[model samples]
Target: MTYSKTWQGFYELLDTVYRTGRPFAARALPIRLGDEEADRAIDLLYQPLRDGEGAVTGIFVGGYDVTEQVRSQAALRDSEDRYRTLLDSLDVGFCILEMKFDEADRAIDYRIAEANPAFARQTGADVAGLWVSEFAPDLERHWFDTYGRVALTGEPIHFENQADVFGRWFDVRALRIGEPAQAKVAVFFSDISDRKRMEEALRVLNASLEAQVAERTAERDQIWQASTDLFCVATLDGRLASLNPAWTTLLGWGEGELLGRPFLDFVHPDDVAATTAAAAGLARGEPQPNFENRYRHRDGSYRWLSWNAVPRNGRIYATVRDVTAVRAQAAALAEVEEALRQSQKMEAVGQLTGGVAHDFNNLLTIIRSSVDFLRRPELPEARKRRYLDAVSDTVDRAAKLTGQLLAFARRQALSPAVFDVGEKVRGVADMVDTVTGARVRVVVAVPDHPCFVRADLSQFETALINMAVNARDAMDGEGTLTLTLTCGTAMPPIRGHAGSQNAFAAISLADTGPGVPPDLIGRIFEPFFTTKEVGRGTGLGLSQVFGFAKQSGGDVDVTSSPGRGATFTLYLPEAPAALEADDRSAAAASVSPIGAGESVLVVEDNIEVGRFCTQILQDLGYRTTWATNAEEALERLGPDGAGFDVVFSDVVMPGMGGLALAHELRRRMPTLPVVLASGYSHVLAQDDAHGFELLHKPYSAEQLGHILRRVTRPGRPRRTA
Candidate 1:
């Protein structure tokens, strides 16, 4: 066989085998089978052929068809190179670890035998050929145990863990790859720090979103439950879907009872139509704002509810407020406003009437005296006497009219004294009958025991008479008029007087006449207000009753229903039982004779009044001095002036009024008698005349003489009756 130059090395190997008397074998030797252009590989065995004597002979060569074997070796080398290249190119870290065990066959540590570039990069350490504990001294023992188990059991394990020392997270896969006697674990892992951070961020974001949702839900729930106003969600068909606790608190119904029920069921019968309309409007997407209706309370009463509602998503959300108390307050305010207006009207009328009455009284005084003088004419013919008599009667009528005006204005001077109201009613029974006329019956009903009150006896009788006359007119002069006396512990509130807590006496004058109208009830006590026709009644009758009652620190009230007749009750503070005996009688009935030697000072603002007063004093046999005003009176009674035994002053003077003069005189001459007279002075109206004698105007000579003598007498009582 022809051999190629590639066989020269083989021939040399064979020659050495013969010389050494040994056999040589070449596993895969390259031999040229054909020409160089088509060369093939061969494996040859070269051996020395020896005789039995063990001497070297010609070499025997053995040839094998090992072309595939040589080719297979080359392929294996290529595969190994590819594998190493694949491992180096991988992004994941890779390592082969040999697990070391203790005497107990328990895994203690792991030695890293091989590591790829990725492993070094991930761990930030060059750890090949080093123990895992050496590379990461603080590595967990669980890592070694896990890898050891995988090597012993030939099981592959996958896990994720953080490397605190390297500040990295990794996803590691450990597998047994070598023989069990020399156990080795291949660990493949990746640096998963970015993925872990991303996953953590996503988790935090989801948690935050969940927390926000929870917070919003809680806020919505809080608002729904905590609101005081009635809050509800109802379907467009009026079925209540939800209601807050306020509905239970305000309407006295449980939430379960109200929800899922028709909302209109709880509405007041009269308000149901309106509530239904409002709901219909809300269903049409038109917002109902401040719509008002009444709802029935659990107590069978109705409460006003104001509602605001809107429609959204086939539901009506509504809020309601209870306005029952607000409505009541508004009504009360209206009543108060009306009462205030009536009071103002009465005040204005009182001022006007009071001014007129004061002047009218003075004129009546002049006329009455002139008429009295004319009636005493000695040359009186029969016709002249008749005319004078008529004049006197007319003067009397004019004086009575002025008195009524003064009473209506509540400015009349009241001479209040303690007297039995029962006796007074009995005593005035005849007068009340006369005023009521024969067509009417006057009945006096008095208790057996005396009921005492501090009031002007004359004015009290007059008030009784005036009420009788008014009742007579109301009944057309044909009804029963009853005057009854009773006592009580407390009295109801009146216009000018607060309600009383003390015992009081009542003089009730009930008449079987037509009752007063409801609309006119409040106006009945007002001055000059009347329901009768013009000329049929003076309208001052009830006014006098009202004024007299108020002036005596008491009040008069009337109760009547239309067509049921009327009763007028006069409430006055009861007098102490002890005072009833002393003040039982009226002011001394008979006048005393004038004090002949006494001097008198008459002070009057009106010239006619002054002259009349001084003339009466002179006629009563007293030396008199007259002053036109309080100042003039004070001047006449000064220390240097001709002083009088007693000083008389008119109360309603222009400057330095008589009350002021009396106060000053009392201070200077405490024992000196001072008498003040007025038709209707503010001082008398205020009930401030004390420590001095007071005489009302339009007094006759006899009354003046009696008062003057009583005041001028020495050692007189400091306080007069």
Candidate 2:
């Protein structure tokens, strides 16, 4: 019997049995057979040995070595500790699902037997040891089936599916873990929601890109098919590669016939060189500016083609437009313009000849009769004076008739001065009252404020009277005439003349009378072109108004329709009130009377007229010199005519005209005074008379004497037209 630290527990058990006369057992009791031997485990049992009387007796022990069994249990416990650590540390959700079956052996539901910590984190619920139906009542049945099949068949499956009940996608691998009858499956799963969303976004983006590509292709094709201009692509050497549908529509050439052919082959022979040059430039990476050439059509005719081309990637893209109609229109316009000019020339000639023949004959008749009566030797002095006066009056009438013609032609000498238009219009209205008769009422609408214009005062008054007379006649002497004066107004376009923004005065004369007929309004201003019966009008009234307006740097506009009456508006450039004040002061200054012995140079082309002019100057007590032409007048002036007080020359003549002579004389002697006289000069009509004193032909002796005296005065400034 031995007792030591290693076998102390076994000794205690054996001692208890012996002291109490009881038996006991001790399993897995530790003991050492020897100090050097390895530790061993033993199972020990104690029992009492007694006689038949059953009194206490000696003890008996029995037991076996359990070292191997104890070692095996220790190894198993260590393995289980490592397995639990792996499950707790894993990121993937781990669970064992026990699938339940119905009477038909079909998978009905699943119970979660075991689950790791990550399983609750992934599924958002701690579902271990619970039936899946209790937590996710609406979970899809396929989940049960999928795991059930793995459990029933002892097979493993890997899959990714969305758990809609939890709004999460899972990547899962499930395998049967126990026996087939157990219906348990071990599942490994991970939440793949972020990856799944990214994949879906990529798929949608791909679909959008495809749709955009298809839409752009459709749009480009539509433009190509529906365009009106020819569109084509060509090689650097001018061979056609592709052409839009417009090419066939415009030139009658099919794509099959034109493709792969040099485009210049269809060009007109005259246009080939230009087309080649343009194509060469485009090939040099220089875009071609728009150019025009001719192309041969299917009918063997040529069409004008305007081409614009650009270069890209060694190819030329061009757009061509057919301009044949445009070219034809331009040609026709030129012809129409030329014909119109000729017709206007002929019409003017006819009007001038007829008017002259009719009016001049009457003037000549009076002159002829006056001459015959003076031929009578027995005529009384009073009778002779009467005939002489008749001759003088007839000459005056003939001169006035010629002046009217010049005025109608817009070729009259104008003496422009600044004056208030409102005042002048009011004064003319008084005269119009008598002219229009008692049957017609005159209404004047003039602003109290003065409106000024720089124009010929006499011509302005004459224009007003002419228009008033015209209105009166149109009204047959029995309608209202309204005269309105407006200042600071712009001129609108009239009779094809462009408008202006400069300040202007508009004097409008409106009449309540039958308006001018539409068809005749265009020719109403033509000379001798009257709407009235032959004896009633000479048709020069409105023409004079037109001429006056243009010569004064303005325009006239007429508005009328059938039964709406007529309004004639005269637009004149407005003049500042300061100019009006200055002109008034100058006009107030007295003009010096005719200077005695003032020498005058009279240049006249007509022999008799020249004689009459010199005679009139001589009778006015002035020394006179006469030249038949402007060239002779210059010669007579001797380069510097120191003796002459003034030079009076006619405007229109052969070779050098009077205006040229005046300009030359002025250049030679800047201080020399010059007076020009013209009946009808185109130069004077189109432009102002170059700031020289001008006298219309058929002048009275008083007019001639007055102009010479004023210009030749010692201290007076040179008088201007």
Estimated TM-score per prediction?
Answer: 0.50, 0.58
Candidate 1, 16-104: lDDT as tens digits: 88778877776665566655654456666676777889888788777777676556556555434434543454445777788898877
lDDT (Cα atoms) of all candidates against the true structure: 0.72, 0.78
Residue 17 accuracy (lDDT) in model 1: 87
Clashing pairs in 2: none
| Candidate 1 segments exceeding 4 Å error | 1-380, 494-498, 579-588, 592-597, 639-643, 713-721
Q: For every candidate structure, what is the RMSD over all alpha carbons to the true structure, in angstroms?
A: 36.5, 28.7
Q: Which regions of candidate 2 deviate over 4 angstroms?
A: 1-241, 244-302, 306-326, 333-341, 380-386, 577-595, 628-640, 714-721
lDDT of 2: 0.78
Model 2's TM-score against the true structure: 0.58
Candidate 1, residue 189: CA error in Å?
70
User: TM-score for model 1?
Assistant: 0.50
